[model samples]
Target: METSPSLAGPFALGTFSSGAGPAFPGLVAGGRVLDLSAHAPTTRALLERWDDVLPLLREAAAAPAGEWRPVAELRVHAPVEPRQIFQSGANYRTHVIDLAVAHEPAGGRPAEQVRAEVAAMMDRRAAEDQPYVFIGLPSSVTGPYDDVVIPSWCTKPDWELELAAVIGRPAFRINPDKALEHVAAYTIANDVTAREVVFRRDMPEIGTDWLRAKNAPTFTPLGPYLVPAAFLDPGELRVTLKLNGEVMQDESTKDMIFGVARLVSYVSQTVELLPGDLVLTGSPAGNGLHHGRLLRDGDVMEGTITGLGTQRNRCRDER
Candidate 1:
């Protein structure tokens, strides 16, 4: 059975609605949703003043249920529409090593040696090298339960379930030790990809083409709920994903080659992270590529990160 964060006392926040009504920022508690837009218009607005708004939200969540609606009656949207999204690549020790072994270079080296070398490189990188970061379009983000449209041209659509950190304060050139303080919340993000397009074949010198491979509309399914950073430990959570009732990815944040603090601080060195910016920590091992299975039309993905809710997205072909 799938287990999620306790929703007993209104600990998470989200954007939800009933029927065709507009989305509203809501407090999630005990399978019910309390609209919080009257207190703070949008999720971004509340995040801008996260420190101040948290107290107010807590008070409202504790108040007697007055306008609360059953969760089943609402449609959940991505909790926040970030101004910018920074995603980490090749940031999981085992995941990258798995890819390296699967696609061994022409060099005459044993597979075991390659794995050992790659693992050593990751250790050194964790201690010295900066995290590999890339940009993603906010327009690619869709609601947690939305459908993913696989473009007719894409033959290798893949799933990469990751933990995304939501920034609550502006951070620039901050050190790793202080980076976590700027994060207000954490949510689930599936970094869906077009495997065949990740690298530029014709322009190999230019390296990756992330924009084409990762930024398709509805490529990123974000947030059934946003759990506050203070409420959970980022490094200890377990991330699990199931495809049509079969487990595909099951790992822990403990396996991350570069943890959240390092990624956030490293990115802040180049980009100014705003209140609503998102930093997607890399996905763990057990992706479809390793399993030799790729997403197809009618496939359903259910991804869950401990303390954050699950995201269920059905894949469809773009006509």
Candidate 2:
């Protein structure tokens, strides 16, 4: 039996298209997909009317009396075309500590010493009550099962699987207590990175160059489906990723220094989050940097978060 967790709700939402047809919003339930093109058109439009559609979804899932098709018949896509992507960095305590310890110069200090220093620094960051968030272009996003093309210049390709919260309501400067109210659904996103170009060699003052380091075609592989926020809890979920069938990242959301609510609240203070915006909480422990095994050409990565579904992507060279 397939062991993947089912959607917490009776149905999930997705984008799909058949041969020679335009893509449409779909409601997935029990191996079947109900085309939602007539109701709200695209997935983004559906999310805009999420409050009204949510009740309709609950009612549809109870009986599924419409013209439902098998999920296997259509081509699945990265569920939503997000207008804005807010990515959190160093949000997970263990992931930060592990990276710091691994990247430390070998002869400089003991491994334990490096870990302790990093741990203390992370604690200070958490106590300060701010999250490090960055902006990402929507053009970098690709289908969940699509191929990731590792550019030739990227000698150190890495994977960071994260829990993505999709925004339903427009929010700006919202409090942490009200942040969850703006979240409509949850999905999966793999923030693939080219580690070498992350820091610019020419300019020390300019800091990170996210444009060249991260934004490449097919670098960000996103969701297979969107599970409603009402059905799942962002906290206490398990995030796991396997490379060539070997487990690399397996950790829980509990280790996050800044949970979903705090991260969302922090981001809203700076920008107005619109419908279909994505908030990507940082990855947990066990990334390629710590494993000492960067991605090779043709490598396959399968990532999963509890009740959100699994995303499997194959790597390809940009030749």
Candidate 3:
């Protein structure tokens, strides 16, 4: 039996459709989906008018209305069609320290010293440095229940479950204090990666190839619902992921070296955040690399964030 995430609020939003039919925006309440295409064509469009539409959603959830359908009868997809995706790297304090120690030279330094130094450095960066952010392709995204194709060439596929903040209002050069004002909702995203291609072997100076390593088809499995930000606190959520029923990643969002507000403000300083854009906070500790166990064919990954809901994806070899 497939497990459904217990939503935190009275309702949430998603995109769904019956077979061969065009997808529509839906207001998900209990086990039913109220078709919302009449109000806004897509979830992105709904968010574009979030201020005007929020009250309507609340009323519908409270009383229930038009074009309702059972969730089991439809196909659920990624909640929003985001025009821009900004992903963070090395944002979690423990995840970065773990990586630093794991990659240290043989017999180079004591693990304790390495950990202490990394912790201090993270503290310093949090106080003085800006976030490390990168762009991701929207083509890489697949639905929450979709099959993730691990390309035959990808020997070390890994999973990075993260919390994704959905932008509702345009924000450029916003203050860190006011960054969250632009975020309308939050969802779950698994930022799947190809480990071997992460660094360019031939060219040493040029570091990290995010395009090749992370932007393959089905590399990002996103959403089951978009829980409104009013009902959830981005800083205090618990993020958990299971690989074939075994817990691999489980941590609190409090470990983030740079919080959501900081990341959003930092990205807005460079890129104009449009309605429907996504800002992905970095994943917590317990990645496959940390466990020395990369993804393989037949791996089933289930990821969940507090209130936002869950994403279940099965891995298959690329055809």
Best by lDDT: 3
Over 1-319, each residue of candidate 2 has an lDDT whose tens digit, in order, gives: 1212466778899999988899999988888888889988889998998899899988887784899988778888899999999999988999999988887776988989989999999999988997899998899999988899998888999999999999999989999999999999999999998888887879969888888777898888988898999998889899999999999999999999999999899999989999999999999999999999999989999999999888889999886
Off by over 4 Å in 1: 1-10, 105-109
Question: In model 3, how large is the Cα lDDT of residue 215?
Answer: 96
lDDT of the structure predicted as candidate 3: 0.91
TM-score for each candidate, following the candidate numbering:
0.95, 0.97, 0.96
Q: What tens digits encode model 3's per-residue C-alpha lDDT throughout 1-319?
A: 1335678888999999888999999999888889988878999999999889889899998884576788888899988889999999999988989877876778899988999999998888888867899999999999999999999889989999999999998999999999999999999999999988988988869998999899999999999888998998889999999999999999999999888889999999998999999999999999998898889889999998888778899999995
Residues 34-57 of candidate 1: C-alpha lDDT, one tens digit per residue: 888787777988899998988877
Candidate 1 global Cα RMSD: 2.3
RMSD of each: 2.3, 1.8, 1.4
What overall lDDT goes with each candidate model?
0.88, 0.90, 0.91
Range of the 10 consecutive residues with the lowest summed lDDT in candidate 2: 1-10
